[model samples]
Target: MTSDTEEQEDELLALHSIFGSDEFVRDESKSAGELRVCVELPAAFMVALTEGETLSQYEISFLPPLLLTFELPEDYPSSSPPSFTLTCSWLTHTQLSALSAQLTDLYQATGGAVVLFSWAQFLKEDALRFLDIDTLLELPSGEHSTQNCSQDSLDVALSEAKNNKHTPATGPTDIQSLDLSALSLEAEQTLQTSEIKADYQDDQSKQISKEDFLNEGSVLLPSSSSGPLDESEQGAASLPRESPPNEDQRLSGRSLTPSQALLSQILIYDAAQQQKQFATTVFDCGVCFMGLLGMDCVQLLCGHIFCRTCLSQFCKLQITEGNVQGVTCPDADCDAAPTPAQVRSLVGEELFSRYDRLLLQKTLDCMPDVVYCPRHSCGSAVIWDKSSTAAMCTVCAFAFCVTCKKTYHGTEACQKKKKKIMTENDAEQPTAAVPRSQEGMKALWDDYVSGSKQRKRLLESIYGRRSLQNGLVECLSEEWVATNSENCPYCYSSIQKDGGCNVMRCYWCKRLFCWSCFAKLPSQGYLDHFDNGTCNHFGSDFFPAT
Candidate 1:
């Protein structure tokens, strides 16, 4: 079974034991009074939280539909082990109060002692609603084999598929045959090529090369620093390691580039900085500065140093009463609020663990149960009873008569249902099928988005090319508009050229000018003549045409 399913079973077993007897309701065979619980969580809740996901430094809240379960004792008045569930989508103040009351009632009625122990404490936030309910279709117990085979199959498939985009191996080495611990570091590699050789001289040269290379060079992974890098310290990160020694000079007698040499130095520096956030801060001789045999000394902002015991008392007494400002350094006449590091150390491992739990609780304070709608048109509230012979919809009252979602309402009938309805609607819908409207909408949306992106890219390229062309033309031309008046300036007549060239003579005055351009010439004494042009008509050399 999956871990989630196994966890579910464990929770139910815990609830059964908590009720005081294995044979519930005085029946050895029947297990109704055993008080089993099941919770249906969303697929997103599949991930088990990592240690990094938690923040323990402050007051927090949690949101959830996590399923929790407990079994109630049969004999209530004499010896009661009270347990109940409060089902809601969200946690209001009233719901929280009611839950607290239920816990209180369970304790008060049962001689102020917990007869029931909490072996299973947490479930995913959304699964809490069906905590005390039954189920249909229990998951198989073959998850161990399935889980093991899944990784191998995925690795093989990923290795073989040419179309896959994701880098399945995450590194150059093939993961299927790799054993990380057995791999040894290579020492004899030199990156210097002919191109790089031109840039760097041997140690024997006087003046070093000054030109910067445009190449991306080698991958410069972040290395350990003499002091912790500010970004690395924020989130948990390991220190960097040194580069392996170059074997090019030692083994093959190959040359190395200056870039490679610099990279090695950087790696070495980072490796040296690995174990430390900063350099060791040594203090001079003083009675107060002395490290005690039992506990370490923590220095406050006021420069007062004290043992852990002093800080804990200050938080409990001063901070608890909301008078933390009044809390100060225990040393004579100095006052300072306690530092977080000091407070954490003072609290110690046990209290820190508790605080961490509280922090998780606060972060996940009141999330409600959420499940996807099983129907095509509607995503409605549908309870999943895994153990049942068939799934019945509460909202539509449509009953599925088969485990495979086929309705056997006529000839085939399960032990659970008394009345069977045979209809097309009551039959189970295929998992792959989507509602017509949803399918249509999805296609339309996809097409629209894809078309929009292609158009945008096309326009951007066109605009970019035009902009470059415009820049060159702007430099070459003086005034872009009306620089050339393509008409006769003397008579204000339209000009046209019909010949192979631009030169033209006016028909009226036989004026020497370009028929295509009636504007003044940039240089002096450039006469225009054209055999074919509108300006070349019957004309005298000195006469002006009316």
Candidate 2:
């Protein structure tokens, strides 16, 4: 037969294999071998309780650690069983008693076989199911109160078992009532060492028996009595108890209330339908023209779908290059653009902020009545009334003209000020002595040329130099019209008598007019006007020589 020491080593090795060495704590100061351990309930059982419900922090706090203290007897496994005590903060006294009874029964059923490992495994894996703890609220109170299981209960039993030197391990007796003292010296020294803190104690005032909780006729109370049931707790009672059909067929098929059953069926159908739809779906990306799953593709408002990878890359490229407006549907002919929310979802927060700012700036730039402060130090956008010509910057308090984007001149038009500058420059110019008529004409021409130059410079300062140069080209276009064309008296369109008779028709207004005096002519033609001698220079050049 194996010696007790060798058997103890083998049992400990087995426990290490099952629970890991970190979970097994041996007291170094004790010659009578003793160990303390902590274990978690299995995930398969926890999932059943948590399914279809979002647990709050308070509800999750009730999941306390299971602490066990055990001592090895000197006798062989063939004659004696290990003396053990189980304690938990989240289970009531009756629940703990029931668990102790079940554990004792399990050991006896094995005919005095070594059963500590089996007992730990059962408590870790099957205790929740055995006690029907189907929800978080059904868990025992976790408040500080006298009803909590005292650690002294376990210590007293351990002390008695240690004193009874001849006590046999094999007996039909109540383990809860059996005051066995089999703890080692180290355990006796640390009997009160692992006491639960005051805050960690269960709220015994709200404690309910397991029977009352599981009873169908009893109305379950909230976890606290200080107030009525909250929305979560009220809805929690109606939630269906979901478990895999194969794992526990009876529990899985347990009948739900009418409303709960309908909800369960709806959820099942929606999940199945979505799975079927997605399985059958194939998305062809518009950008890369690659086939992908429905989930891999993003659909724009234009009803065009592209793979998320391609769309995200497209958006990032456009935003990086400051081409935010170009971040639209990739289709060559489509004009649809993604919304701000869509861009945010695709490009992430940092890049989306850039895109949004660029988009807003572009929009403000297009508004005629909106102008950014001309001061480079304070280039904040400012809005003016459409009818007003100036605006005051809200941020910098800088007043500026909306038209010229210069300093604001109240009640004065920017163009009127520019014209006044040109007139003043002309008045200051010195006139050299010359013949009377010739000098007057020469001075007029010189002043006209100087005035044009001054106007060009003023426009250049208001607009950019390049923009003013383009405007000069347009302004010079009027010269061509003045030289080769005469204005239609009716519509004021410059009508060029290009190789046609003096009876000219305005292309814009289509009315007949005399090229000589620019007067509306009879419908008959210029021949009738000449016949009546309405104006001179009929047969010759219609416009008299200037």
Candidate 3:
């Protein structure tokens, strides 16, 4: 008994080895030693309804994997059967129930032998065939029709098996009796009617074939037939007709019948499948550590596979950071770069536009003769030609000198304009005519006092005394304006007396400014600037007198 148990355990382990550990799970909750296995049905066995067509490759590959939970009994193979449950989300409850019942029937038919592996294989390869499911949408609505059709198919299969004489007679009987009681009376009647029709058609086919062979000599002369051959006879006669003169048919020198066309399509499909199998391979992405199919991954020239998602995200990060040239392979040691097509395919259209723009800008930056428009708001590229020192922006139509980077001066060399500006600036500078001393300082003060009295009288003659006094006060305040008062850096409004702390906000511009240096503060409120060295007066009063 112990040897038998060990053998059963060994068989279960061997099944696990064949399927892989990823597909099998050992359940500890069941003290009886249960195993949970997941199985993905083959693409050919799965079906779906899409766009009014019943022949779609089901989207089961995208759905959750099917799970089979089963427990082994102590004397499983010899006397006791395994206990199991099948779970799937893609199928409806009724479909699952039907499948579960059929699975149980399959196990019972094999008696007390080990049937877990057989059950798994059946569900993976033949579950849809056994369930009479052509498409997932047909499951719920065509239950009655499916029952009748499946019964007819079963009868047909049994008939073929019997005619072959190699199949065991009892096998057909066992299958026929397994679930016949579950079928409704109407379904059974329909199945019988279909069988009778099939038999009549077979007889008619044999009779027609015999008649065609006997009348072959007469058919050679078209005048033998009375009126016109039937549709089937006309089709058969057309097979020997001259081939169409089209280039495609002329290559083979023969026209293909429906059967031949279907066969060629099958051959082409098989070739495509072979190519697909050879091309695709699996690999784990270096960045995200996710398993991805070869088609869904982008392999760098350095031979590292990065999943499309991670590669796109990396490219997007680099492009958004204005590092278009730095969008290379993610590996630190590798310097391989993605091609423009690869980058365009990975990142979407909007981000690719930014990438393209930056790439063009970088290319222009390396050229010595290319300069952008001098306008601050419109910085389109402007190409300088040898004919002229100025370049006109194609986008904004702004013409500028390539040498001085300023508005174009007609027919004047940039060097001459620059020299003239330098000479005029030198002439405007104040000069020290004598040596510096107290006497020179007194002489300057006396000249300033007389100049200011004359300016006050001139201002009073031009305006009124009140306006003159206000202007004079403003001018006097200008001497200590930097130390005593500050202007709002944003709008340059003079802030004479602030009521709040050193971190003052401009009422006119509604922007934060530091009272000490009158520099603008961030919009995130007042306290952030003090910590960042932008403003030093964190706790000081707004207007501390000098």
Candidate whose TM-score is highest:
2
Candidate with better TM-score, 1 vs 3: 3
Best by lDDT: 2
Root-mean-square deviation (CA) per prediction:
40.8, 25.3, 25.1
Off-target runs (Cα >4 Å) in candidate 3 are 1-4, 28-63, 135-356, 359-546
Clashing pairs in 3: none
> What local distance difference test score does each model get?
0.33, 0.51, 0.50
Task: Please say which candidate is ahead in lDDT: 1 or 3.
Answer: 3
Across 330-407, the per-residue lDDT of candidate 2 in tens digits comes to 999998997666688889998887678667766766676666666645556778887878799999899888777778
Give the C-alpha lDDT of model 2: 0.51
Candidate 1 — worst ten consecutive residues by lDDT sum? 142-151
- What RMSD does model 2 have? 25.3
Q: What is the lDDT of residue 544 in candidate 2?
A: 49
- Residue 295 accuracy (lDDT) in model 1: 23
1-546, model 3: which lDDT tens digit per residue?
475486577767767577755455443233122233333344653333332343333223222234555556666656655555444433544455566667656756776566777877877767666666543422221211111111234475467535553323422111111111113212332121121100001111011111232222111210112111233433311111111111121114455322232222222323333334424977798898998886778776567779989999999999766678889999888888887767888888877887786677567667767766656455556777968887899998888887676788877876554344444224322222221443333332322223334333333333434333444445444666867766678888777764656777777988887776676778786576677675566455554544
Q: Count the backbone clashes (under 3 Å) in each candidate.
A: 35, 14, 0
